[model samples]
Target: MAERRVSAGRRRHRAEWLRWGSLAAAVAVVVVFLLSQGQDIDVSYGQSPASSDAVAEGGAGELGDVTVPSVDEMAALVRADDVVRLPGAIASWDERRVREAVGDAEVRILVAPPGLDEDERDRVRDVDDATVRVIGTEVTGGIYQASADSAVGWRAQFAVGDVTDQMVALIAQLRDRPAPEAVDQFDWRDPDEAELAAVAADLRATGVHVGAGATLDGIPEDLAASAFPDRRAWYVVLPRQPFGEPVPRYGPALAELFPDTPVVVVYGWWIEYHGPHAGDFDEVVGASFYAQLGERLSLYDYPQRNVLAGYLARVTDVRYAGLFDRPLPYRPFDPLRVALPALPWLFTACVAVYLVLSARPLLRRSGAGARTGVNARLAGLTALAIEVSGLTDVSGNPSLTRAIGKLGAAGEALARNLPDRHVRSLLDDAEAELDDTARSLGRADYRPDSYLSERLA
Candidate 1:
């Protein structure tokens, strides 16, 4: 009879475990389904247009009167792997142009100058007319990379700054070329002839092919052509002030004349600065600006040169290497992306509650101090959560630390109700561990590596 009773108890335990497992699986499926909904609402990966379709379908027509780089010119640049600088206001057109220009070349699109209203972003996304693989436009400055199955990752790469330099450096590394040298010292106070001579001499000395010309109106093509003849890429220096009249004509003229050459326009009030290094330009920025611009040039019909003016400072200031280290994949209207912060906490809370409720009967089977066990179990779970949040270093780290203190209070209350000495002893040990962990967290000296080490080994 005793043997039969033991067998029956074993069957009951297995049945209970099976029931709990099924519930857990169901909860997991629900959470996953909710998260996956983000990908479904995004641009369909299956709908990515072919390069021929992009070129034939044409995105230039949508750009109104904007000046577009010639497809042949773009192809040559792509073939030579040269970087072209353009404007960000024409990003929609640029994206399309890049798609058409590279044919089947591996490319990455990173949308930036974040904090645009949702409607504005949606409009921009719709007009760009290509499936974006990553969205690097999060307010927290993270990259949402696309996973192997093309699903967006839940966590973003935590980083901030202008990614232009990193992108430039990355391109240089990829192409096996040295970092582009900067020409920050230019003699802007000299006479027109003297200034032109100095610019030409600087270009020759550094082997840079970029030209510093007032405009294409009277500047000799020989001067511009001679600047960087063999490289097939050209740069022009533009004036920053009195931009209302001269600027419009200046842009179109370059596009019209050099229909085959990739152009980068460096804008500043060059003549105002009389010092020796007065007309200097940040080489990294120039290289990065052109590289990014080149990559996105295919989207607009006409390039607006200074749209990234406000962003220049921030972009150049980014010291973090992780910002553009990976590609950010984003979907339009992803509810999950917007609600990232609250989701993890909500899921943890719901699961913890469910487990406590589901295990109520088992606690009662002990026939004494069942309620105390339930409370103790809850305190233990809460302490674990606090420890995890402290270790992970999320935005909610402070709140999680405070929660540890609260858990300690609750654990003490629950332990006082326990009648058994051994049970109380175990509860005391657990509470002591929580106290130590909480103190470490409070000191802000707790490293995740050490916390992980304790758990793992």
Candidate 2:
């Protein structure tokens, strides 16, 4: 009992601590999260080995293990490389990190995200390649310019060989003015330079091959001429793979354009955040991604906290916990089930309530008048009355008293005159109860409440 009490005390303490600790931890995490939120730092995650039914540890926050890297052959392309590619919407590269990742790379390629108005992404498809890599899925075009500090003169990456001073000046100028004139949507504007040779020579020594993707015809010949070194400069495009072959294979135009160049297929409409209801948030997330990352965008549920953050905590914590113990076991859950395995306490509470309510009335009324055996007192009273009235007792004898209750047969006729059934039931009940009393054979006390004493005395 003491051990159980100690255990109970410990349980209560632990529960209290958890409650308080959780509250404190929650506030701390929130404050810390908010504090760290606007910085360049961002978080990441994946699934757990502990749970089979569990897709991710962060519970509802995780969208399952996915990113551009988790997708098919594209995973190889997402790997760290001198090359940074963009083949989706203007919103796709909106994330500040991704924006920087692409904008600052030795080479960058971009495609328009799907659902673009024909004019919006017209520059992307004009390229001769089989694919057009989408740019920013979650970023707006306005914010993409602001955050990248690459004010509207759009230029893809260029490989350097004999870096002229003019080319160096052009690189810097392109870095400053990324999207040209905001004038011709398909102009594909880039700065022309031949100013710095040393940097270009240094770039070539790295033995890095860099090519970018575009809508082949989209880059106005003027812009392509300015952004790249020569007409020999190349770009990529994407076409739908032939269906029904065992493995989907790239078709002719895809192969013909850049046979020696790295091939990156751009999928604009691929699902991002898929768990249960994936499509619901994708539009807003993919469209506003760039500005949101730059903190220039606001008012949406797809923010890191609402979307990726919860997932980060859920999966990371669960994954981290595995270092100490096997993770919580998993089984499928049915919400509608009346008997859920998680609700054992509810069942126990119901049963305990039933027993308590039932037993209380029994315990409370145990010694009410009937239990005191008033009928035995009435019998003694009747004997006195009979002694006074010259009437016979229960045995049908003209006697004042009789030992033993064979007299009950005689008493039955007299008992019919009584009005209260409760009193009468006492007579029936008393005889059985008499056997149960502790004073069953003890001498009676003649207190007024003690009805059996009067008759015997």
Candidate 3:
């Protein structure tokens, strides 16, 4: 019985140890998984030294005959004047107006001559911190860069014409505002003033601050007004032109106009937008809306008021819904990608549940074993009382004496299995009582008649 009990105890302890080992192994898996996830390194879009080397090697291999302006010279020119027009560059008569509009601001504009080669364009692009830098060549169109944080170089196709008026108008809207107003509409081309005002009123009704103007001359005063306080985004609607005609690239210029906020331009049949929120605008309202507008305008030889109104209404709807506030929809079959961010947390929760389940049975068995041990000890005490009272001797029954001795042996076995110090003391006391009884009964030695002893042997 003792040997069997010892084997059972070893098996229970091994099972308990296995449960703890499993938990440790589960924790190790979570740690390893977390370590494998690693960190994300942010990559900036700004030009770097290595990128400059690559561009020099891959682009315009040799500087050739094209003379490129030095960075020092460009910086000096910008510091001296707000508007610098290099030789052969597009001449704008509105340079004085641009200067007047820019007054005291750090903004600078440099217009490169038409027909500048790639090397010359690259040199102009290399000029940093300029508010507006444009290369006026038709072959590569024109390139403009703004000094804003989210500014990116843009290319616009413009006919060789006096852009001085356009530049002055752009600067006027850009200047004095300090910030972009929400849903400001500029009608650079001829449009119905009443219809435009109606569109603005509808947008205002939807709880957005809107400012609309039909002329470029009124921009400065309108911008200074306190009616429109929210500076967030702007939309420019240019006069509709023929499908194949090359109109001035006002979209890129308008994008540079605000610098900080997104600007959308509806020029002729083309729709262009730029800024940090450009992607959000595309996700909320796609380019298809403008494409359909172009298709509808094709049916009419002249600009229809209702058609334009419908288009403006759509723009108003997008503005009312908050263009940049909406989140982009997830791509198809992208469940795993979306859930990947939360995978570590989900894995931890699953591991915790597994640990709880694994330990529950072990805990229950330990508690049951403790209670059974105490009950067996009490039963053994009852048998010891019967022996002490001389019940078996009074009946003169050998079977009764053997049964009582077996019960006492079973109790001793239970007491040995118990871990409590009090149970051990009870076992020692029971053994002392058995020894006294044995001596009293005329036995030379005390021997417990346990049935398990014979069976186990």
Which candidate leads in lDDT?
3
lDDT of 3 by residue, 126-193 (tens): 66645666554211112421211111101121212234434444454556443222221122443355
Range of the 10 consecutive residues with the lowest summed lDDT in candidate 3: 147-156
Whole-model Cα lDDT per candidate?
Answer: 0.35, 0.30, 0.42
Sequence-dependent TM-score of model 1: 0.23
Q: After superposition, how far is residue 22 of candidate 1 from its true place, in Å?
A: 13
Tens digit of per-residue lDDT, candidate 2, span 197-287? 3223322353121223321223223332322222222222222212211211222233343344222222111112222112333233333
- Cα lDDT tens digits for candidate 1, 303-334: 22222221232222321111323122243575
Cα deviation at 98, candidate 3, in Å, is: 6.5
Report residue 378 deviation for candidate 2 (angstroms).
29
What local lDDT does model 3 show for residue 202?
40
Question: How high is each candidate's TM-score?
Answer: 0.23, 0.18, 0.27
Of the two candidates 1 and 3, the one with more favorable TM-score, higher being better, is 3
- Worst lDDT run of 10 residues, candidate 1, spans 149-158
Could you say which candidate leads in TM-score?
Answer: 3
